[model samples]
Target: MTRPAHIAHLADPDDDPFGPEASDRYFNRELSWLAFNRRVLEEACNPAHPLLERLRFLSISGSNLDEFFMVRVAGLKGQQLKEVDRRSADGLTAGQQLGAITEEADALMASQQAVWGDLRNALDEARLHVLRRDEVDAEATEWLETHFREQIFPILTPQALDPAHPFPFIPNKGLSVIFDLVRRSDKEPVRELVMLPVSAARFVRIPGEPARYVTIESILKRFAPLLFPGYEIGGAAAFRVLRDSDMEIDEEAEDLVRYFANAIKRRRRGRVIRLELETGMPEALAAVLKSELGKTDAIITESGNLLGIGDLDTIVDENRPDLKFPPYVPRFPERIREFGGDCFAAIRAKDIIVHHPYESFDVVLEYLKQAAIDPDVIAIKQTLYRAGKQPAVINALIAAAEAGKSVTAVVELRARFDEEQNIYWASALERAGVQVVYGFLEWKTHAKVSMVVRREGGKFRTYCHFGTGNYHPVTARIYTDLSFFTADARIGRDAAQLFNYVTGYVEPVDIAKVSLSPRDLRSDLLALIDTEIANVRAGLPGGVWAKMNSLVDPAIIDKLYEASGAGVEVELIIRGICCLRPGVPGMSENIRVKSVIGRFLEHSRIFAFGNGAALPNDGARVFISSADWMPRNFDRRVEYMLPIENPTVHDQVLDQVMVANLIDTEQSWELEPDGRYVRDEPGDKPFNLHRYFMINPSLSGRGAAIGASDAVPTLSLRRRR
Candidate 1:
């Protein structure tokens, strides 16, 4: 699990000018995010990845770009509509950003199409084919005809476009085919529309072949003439409409549930932001469609591939295991096994940190389930931000409430794209007698902290869990996150206070071990950065290293710039948007930024600062947090940052986890000061962080006897401060 020595060759931060309007001072966050997606697309292009896995990355890139437009680009469009002249911290006006985003998005799509073309050819060779209508064999054509007449025609509804019939409303992310039909009687051409079914499978599996399939759009287009019997079909085009899906909830509403429910309804009819069309669409028809849809800022992108390739997930069959990453079973920590599956008994001995996708998340599920069944457990409190459709955590909470143990769940109703799901869960929880509390209207409860009050030996003892990700079981299998279980009195006390603050609206006091955002986390992070600056002044080899999903807070960026100016070495592993420009001489010469995009998503957050010594020294302070260095995370969301105290857990995170990411060569992308990312060139020894975590057992998760196996990462650098 060791990484090759490569960090020493990267350009040192000491290489620039401190300026307010320097060309290389800051990178545009929007452009930076697009760069991250490009890296994901590169994985799809990489020859080393399995064929289906490459398709998965391409599909993910498509889905990610859709979200970016629906939210980030939509926000920008709104600002431009309102004539707000405000510019981003990177100095681009809203209008300028929209233009830049469109250009980058187009380039990304072009790259995706090229990669997809390669994948399509490879899939053909692998016996799985995405057949165009003309390419379908005679045997398949018979099955497809019957499939369309029986399966599709029954559900198909074609709307005639004329003066009497207004263009029918299309839902968000809906794909449709617009057609020009000529009436045989009048010898006049008429405009018609056929909206694709939303619930239908995106790809229809051909019966003879195992993996061969045809897109729903292709099927619709082939049988479209059957949809119009009275007229001769002239020109037809397949297009997709992307509407603004951002929900706007009123903060002053009396009933939070009702407000959110209504907002979800309104979200369906949101303004159209983008329209995607197939290449070779008629220019006259495109103009007509644009005029009918009254959105002045509607973005139009014409593609040669399928309209919505994100739906390719439907055909990525699980039957072909060899076409994906080799399945790795998650290790249910030996620490829990040592206590015979009793989480409480295991936590009593020592704290444990579980890295997900490699280490199991079932432990978190079992911990909650055990609390629900344990008579000694009296009260349970938890916060859920983005629990998926079949979250086991919600089930455990409901069971506990039904069992009569006092249960309170703070559910964030504004988790974007998950509002409808969260609202339903909130109602279900309330029906089951679990006290459902919608957190602050102005701020989202984004923290992942759960607390249990247990009656241990006639005295109440509290157990707490902190996480860098959500409590969703499905996401746990793919997203790399952290789950920390602790019995420490101070952490438990802090957890209880934080929950009380959210549910009771009481300001917490005497909570010192962990930092909470929207109150003081920003200042605390600044203080850590300042400590690095102070260390450099004291003749110490000061350094700062942080890994998070994004870094966009202007003030925090300024603090890091100052730390860099003071000669403290700084390195950031930002998986997504990064506003700060590293390697800028004079201002940020001592700073570098790199992003990791690969098999497993990098979602965990870790911040380690050299108080007065080099990074990885025993004295260096390390903290794991649910918050990213973003303004919204700090100012508009509830978040938590936990300082790693246990010697084993600390080394496991800083030495093993952070070091693995910092040295990744296969899928790493280093961002230059000029707002471009250069992929790391493979050396003689190629190291992939995802593969490293796959084969290695965690330190704290492994118990005393069998935990010392060769698969466990060796602890050679354990220096405690």
Candidate 2:
């Protein structure tokens, strides 16, 4: 009957329970993200993981931090420069956040370097050696010199740092070695810079029995003499710089593609936000760098070994299968298999949900591939946020156009970091006679939806596919996502309306099944949470469970805190950047938050509400979503939330996917009241959801082979192998 303590304090209202201890109410968004990266880094140090897999984890952490600096940190720095002294939810100002983030990030970078050093030993133990010049044998040195002359020396360009040469421009995330060079006769030291060729391999492989390689930085240091002709090589230190990469585009631009292309060029010249120098560099050389780059000490980082650990991925040997995760073959849904891979017939049987990584994304491609070639199909529509390197999806769309069927693709040119790929896709799609439309400049069409109109018995019918991840084949192998296929008339109509809304700016009204954000998705979410609270107040079983990538929207957190206080159990699985403070006594004690980090990325968004019954109880409410509980998703982007009304689909999402995530103990980390994460211990009985999914198939996809059950089927560590 009364407002929850947290909800009563929007904007930290006076006398609000949430405002009294503002610092205790939520975690700082920037720091929360860094913590997630820490979790990823932990996997690199985890000996349980394969050697190359550990390196992969370390590489991922490095890349994650790089983006954090480029976007989040860069934005915060901009705010600081503009004197925007506003406090985040955790009561930290822009400057304060930067100060704190720098501390955390510095420690994380150190940990990464340490792990890489130890991992190098693990690699050598496995006979995959990463050798330094000193470690290389005389024979290996001769071989290196020969290879250096042929492969590397040809590309070296030395720039003298004198009045005539001035300092050369280094690209963002660019690697270069600073030299204190001296002329033989003058005996005066002259500073110089040698940019590492970006086109060359990061590590030069040495020809040997036990695979060996030397980092390019090491090779540069060893061969600096050869490149510098008469000048003697003095002191050298390798350094790298990371610059602001977040793009700013004019919303009113006539051509989105042209604007993005030009903006990307400007992004390369943005202000430098972070710098890394090898530890123990000459103070004189460091001073020259400081003056040349005009950066403060706050942005400077010292590397223990090699700079840019993310580049470690380049050395991941594909031949060394024993040093990586066992290759997994995704299961093709039996229903589709039985239907001779005809996605339409399988969907016609009933609504189908395919859990990805475990279940192949080929089913999604099957729908598009079939539509492109099928004689009955007359129209194909889809939204692409990130197409990745997969030629299959785009090829299918192009084939549909070549077949003379009407094909439309609403490409979001603003998909961060994928802007270039999308630009190319847009151009290619247009050249193929497909209708290409860039969605509203104000809102990115982040929702992934596809519809195929086919002629059957003189009537046109639409088949739909909704996914929580990109159309990226590479990501599908590592990101755990969902793909739902259905021939249901209501959903198809809703899909058609959505496609129209995105491509044609037609504000959809009277939508039947799906909820769209920036319009009604948030309202629908609030109403669902309210239902759970009301159910609890009415003395019925009530609860709320949501799994998403983030939870930064204050309104959503307030509602969650409301539900938690009203005796509605709340469990959240937010993989990154959760702002809500869970398990805070007197505020959100009933809310429990957990993050899962494992072999696969937890990306699929699923929600469940008791709806006046216990969770997953006979007919509890269930839904799949392409949006997280974040402000950008709710207010600035196009997103979708689809209700799971079909019996089998509901069971599959709630009883299977959601349940497994909740029960996973092996890869889960619990969030505490103080914002610290504690990894769950198996205690002799570990349950790994990833392993479970890899070994087993989804119940809904089993088709007639599974026995019918009255109760929703559940699987747990104890219940299933």
Candidate 3:
């Protein structure tokens, strides 16, 4: 994907700060991800959030770190162990990146503990106490004793760590306690390892008014004598293990389902990537754990009293609405209701976009449900990636197939940790007479698309629902994403071609109205950047505004740098990992980057360009996508980027959605060239994008029901000098 010849001379190798030879131009992707997690940790410290909400953020940070170690660190360790000398985009070798990641991750883990400590105290003040072992009063102890004997002791199994019995296998993310015990009979020392049952709740709540709780580990330690009656308890501490959970697909495997089933089992026993011990673990016990489970180059960290901090989310679920974010109910699209809930009628009139978490995701499900029961509907094609445990979406598909409609589901089994669930979904879908196709062995099908064909008037009209997020109802309530419902023939044809490309291995050729990856998506994006540069050179207005989860693709970043050098004003709202260094003097001085992390996750992907006019205008180009600006998204995934052509939908996405993100100050963080993110200061008029969206109706979703008196507020960008 080379730049156009007309603008090839725009970059001066000798003077370009982001030139190919500049090693320092990009930040390390791993370190940048750690930095993003730090931003999440910072939210735990933000006093503006409700107390339990802050605790929720802290728990999220802990969970994020666990996955990072299980996948990212494990991959690096694999490369290092295999003696592969591959380097990162920023020019660091595998070993070097691992060293840096360890440093950053350790500090991040420490910050998470610190935040947890603060939240724990805050919880106590709010009348929700997480009582320590010593704090358990006589009344509580009597009650807990019965609870332990009845509920927990029955599941207890203690294994001695001796030559006779080898160390027990700890599952990935397993939390256990190593006990130092001396036999009462002979004063003989014995070490026992007690693995915590995954079925048990991490926190056991006492039935009382103040809502008191205690950690299961604490209860076990307090009642160690009950489990080991013949021994006196000595030094004991808790520990947890994080194993390498990443799966490797064998290219030569005969069956994908069987391969993944075995792979999931293997992942449970994969090499331990991290060992976290309590801060006060005895040296003898720590050494035993290290020698046994830390055989590989596993990072060992000494954590606080809490081992699995991610389990704090269980406590956050307590019925304490007073200490959490205010309850929010998403609004169903007014457009869909305008047709008396007829999704086909709304789309047949014109295109519409549903903003999730603000507008309902149930609308997406309703569209499929309607199609399932519609006698005129003849066919349905959907892509499944990260559908949550619920079967709402799955049930709709099965209904459509059972209704005698042609239904095909392209289920991706390589969706990271969601592999097992995807497999189960695929099997269930196939059993329901749905033609389930697992897309390419190498490239994952990550596109979020659903198409339905219905006979209308005299011809078959195809209606497509393209989303920037998954069809999962749970995530839809908290993730900010876009769902575009369209009956436009061009997009409908493109959607059909996309399905064919995935199901039949028929490559899409000269597709109209959309760009698909592993083909020309990257080159197409570059061409768009080139157009912005050319517009500047031709003395017309030039600008670019894009938002995504991450920005790590070197080719795309370099093109943005060239565009910035050519006087195209570039603005990006990347929520997570971003390796590009914005505002470098000679490299991207005209570019600015910010991240928005707030009440809801920013998961939507949007891109807009000034087509010979200033942005937020009718002449601008807008598109929503299922791909982020990352290497995995571009080179190894089946993704799509579709343009927003309908004027009302275009105005809604660009004017309301994109503009609110740009103008948001409460949850924004400005990125510096030095890789530090400074929080955006919300001065006098502190505008919150989330709050704005929650209150106002989206333009396209408002439909004709919105009268002049029900005027939705307008937003405009601050013109650049």
> Cα deviation of 157 in candidate 1 (Å)?
1.0
TM per prediction: 0.94, 0.95, 0.95
Q: Specify the poorest-scoring 10-residue window by lDDT in model 3.
A: 1-10
Model 1 residue pairs with clashes: 13-589, 13-590, 14-589, 16-585, 16-586, 17-585, 618-719
Alpha-carbon lDDT, every model:
0.83, 0.85, 0.88
**lDDT for each residue of candidate 3 in 583-618, tens digit (9 for 90 to 100):** 887888898999999999999999998877754574
| Prediction 2 TM-score vs. true | 0.95
- lDDT score, candidate 1, position 419: 89
- The TM-score measured for candidate 3 stands at 0.95
Model 1 agreement with the true structure over 233-343: per-residue lDDT tens digits: 788888887878887667679988888788888888888888888888998778777886646678888866677767777767636887988888888887898899999
Candidate 3: misplaced stretches above 4 Å? Answer: 1-22, 703-721
For candidate 3, the lDDT comes to 0.88
Clashes of 3: 0
Candidate 2 Cα outliers beyond 4 Å, as residue runs: 1-20, 296-298, 703-721
